[model samples]
Each structure stands twice: as C-alpha cells, then as structure tokens.
Target: MKTQIFYFSSTGNSLCVARDIGNAIGGEVELIAIPGALKAPRPVTASAIGIVFPVYMWGLPALVRRFVEQLQIPASTYVFAVATCGGNAAGTLAQLRTLLEKKGILLALGEVIRMPGNYTPMYGAESERSQKKRFAKEKIAIRRIAPLIADRKAGKVDCGTWLGRRLLSGFVYNGGMKQVPASDVKFRSTEPCNGCGLCVKVCPVGNIVLVEGHPRWQHHCEQCMACLQWCPQVAIEFGGRTQGRRRYHHPECSASDFVW
Candidate 1:
C-alpha cells in the first residue's frame, strides 16, 4: 500500500512511533509532518493514511483537530490514527473517530501507545530505567500495530468506555483546551538560557522566535514540549513549574529529526 503517515510531535515520541510503523508496514510509507503538511494544504489521496500524534489533555491537540478538519481524504482510503501518550489515551482516539465521521470517513483503526510522559507542568520525568522500559515496550507495541494496518483491519476503536472518556476528557476539554492556542504564555526561559536558538528551530509550528537573543512565544503553541525537552541548557520552563523537571525526548530522535 502507498501509506502516508501525517504526524505531529513535540518531544519526539509520536514521531518515533510513526517512523517505526512506516518501516514495519513494508511499503512506500511516507512520513509527513503535520505542521509542514499544513503549509501546503491539498486533498490527500493515498491507499492508506495514518495520522499519528501525541495525546494531549486526554484528547487531540487543538492544532491536530484543525489539521484533520482541513484534510480532504478520498472515500476508499483506509484511515487510521495512532495516539501516543504517557497515560491512558482516554477519549483521544474516540475524538479522532468523531472528527473523521463528520467528514463521512470511518476511521479504520485507532491505537494508543504509552511513552514517557513529558508534561512537566503536571510532573517530572520518570526514572531513566523506567523510561528505557517504556522505549522497549513502545517498539513491541508498534510492531504489533503495523501488521493490522497493513491488512486494513477495522474493529472497535480503542478508546475507553464512554463514561471514562467523558469524565476524564470533559473535565479539561472546555477550559484547558480553549486555552491551548495561548498556552505558550506559560513558557519562559530561565537564567540558564543562552540564546542558543535551538528552541526556535525545534518548534514545529514556528511559534517561537528570537527576541533580542531570547525566545518569545506567539500564542499559537501546541505545548509539545519540544523546546523544553530538547533545550541543552535545561533553560525552558513551563509556568515556572518546570524549572527543575527533568527534560525528555525520544532517545532515538534528535533536534534534526524534523525532516518530515
């Protein structure tokens, strides 16, 4: 199948998942960055289309929802989604299914893979040993999902029960999500920042720009934590809460991995 995987990532987990699946699916699988794809919007025509991204606030990131809304998929395409999260995927997969449904396209598959959590506002990074364990498990999970996608398998979307989904996602969906576009307001660079300009480079949305050698947010942030996690000096902080939090990104990925 001519598979095209459109993905969005902040700290690299979702991108790594997309890469593994694209490699395992055994075809011409093209990994496309969602931000870059949005730059030139067009009707997407492919035998298989995969939307891979990190789950935020128990649901899709606001930018991702917009991306899906703008997507134009052919009727016969096998559409799938893989949501990577540190916790339960909750209603994230179901949310994608609903969005696709609105477009008259049935989401053929939805899967969630748990990776190391990087939302420092809520917690610190896990132990290095624990993170390694997650990386191993992530590979195994992707291995299993690749074949199902290759076969165009469709069953129950993997979202949790309706009650759990509503209870978990609804709590913050209205309040927190509405603030996502402006959530960059919480980010600030500490004294350790040296104007390396790396944050500006890693931001997938081009939300960060150099301002007199300091990074400034444009309020269109996705909160992907790329700048926070990938900053070499441990400088970026989220609402002053992430000052001491350990930064993390997919071990297999680097600052230069955004080619797609």
Candidate 2:
C-alpha cells in the first residue's frame, strides 16, 4: 500500500518521526512538507495518509489546523496523526480528531511522542543527557507506532483534562492565533548578525526577508521560532526575552532536511 506523510516542523522532531515511520512502513513513502503559503485544501489519495506535527499551545498550530480544514481525502484511506510535544499535548490530538471528523475523515490513529523541549521563550533547551534520554524514548514510540500504522489499526491518543481541552486550550490557542499576525515585530537581529541569510531560509513562513545585508521580519509570522533557534551566529532574538537563552533544534535534524 502506498503511504504519504505530510509534516510541518520548525526544529526536526516531527520530521524525524515522519521519516522513521515512512521507513518502517516499507512502501513508496512520500514525505511532504507543509510550507507557509498554504491557502487551500488539496486532494490526497493513498492507501494511508498521515500527518505529523508539533503541539502548540495545547492544540494544533494554526497553519496545521488550516491545512487539515482544507484537506481532501478518500473515505476509505487509512488516516493517522502523530503529535510531538515537549510536554502536555493537551487537546492537540482531540482537536485534530474533531477537525478531521468534520470532513468525514476517520482518523484511525492518534499518537503523541514527547521530545526535547524547544520552546525557548519558556525555558532553555534541555541538557544533552536529558535530550538523549528523550530521543531514546522517541525511538521506542516510533517503533511501536510503525506496526500499528502498517496494519492500519484504529485508535487515538487521549487529550487530558476536561477544562484544559474544552475551554482553556481553545482560549489560549485562539489567542495565539490572533497574535500571530503581528508577532514578527518582536523579532530583531543583534549586532552579531553577519548577513548570512540563515534566518531567512530557516523560516517556514517566508516571513523573513533580507534587506541590504541583514534579515528583516515581515508581519505575517507563524512564531515557529525556527529562524531564531537555528541562527548560526546566535543573532536573532525575540525582543529581550531570548537574548541569553539556549536554542534548540532536533539533534538529528539539519538545515538541509528542511529544504522543500
């Protein structure tokens, strides 16, 4: 059976899981990237269709949610999703399941894999030892999920807390979405910036543009923090908040992996 996995990853955690799952399924696996310019639902027909992405604000990222809303899939196609989060997936899987159901898509499987935390605005990157431990856990989770996906088994990952899922998560996620449009104004490059354009390229939303030598932020930011986290010279900062904090991307993920 043909399998295709669509993914959006700022760091590399989601991409890594998608690739691993694809390898294990052993068919023609197409790993497609969800870019920033997603404006329409596209048709997808395969024996199996999967989406792997991170959990943001206890729910789906706005772009990913938009992608799901517009996606067109065959009724019989086996559908699954995997959400990667640093902590509490909260309502992510539940939200996705509800959204897919609205489109008559039966999401057969929902899984969550915890990876090293990457939300630097809240905390610095985990220590190397801690990250190593989490990566090991991620590997085992992928192994367990692959066979189920290969078998087209049906199940879901449960989101916790009635209050969190029904009320709190929706509020926070919606507020985050509202803030997304103008969030780019908070990002600025430091004096260390050398016009390498790494930030411009790392941004999935194409929100960064190079003016003369340095990078400039456009108003439509996803706040994925890829550009800030992956800057080679540690030049990008979100206001004064991220100045001295550590940056993180999946250890196994490189800039090349993000190329289309």
Give model 1's clash tally: 0
Candidate 2 C-alpha error for residue 100, in Å: 0.7
RMSD of each: 1.6, 1.7
lDDT of model 1 at position 153: 87
lDDT for 170 in candidate 2 is: 79
lDDT of candidate 2 over 34-101, digit per residue (tens): 77326334456578999999988888887788788777777788999999999888888889988988
C-alpha lDDT (0 to 100) for residue 160 of candidate 2: 66
lDDT of each: 0.85, 0.84
- For candidate 2, the clash count comes to 1
lDDT of 1 at 171: 76
Best prediction by lDDT: 1
Cα lDDT of model 1 by residue, 128-171, tens digit: 89989988998898787888998988745788778757877767
* TM of each candidate vs. truth: 0.94, 0.94
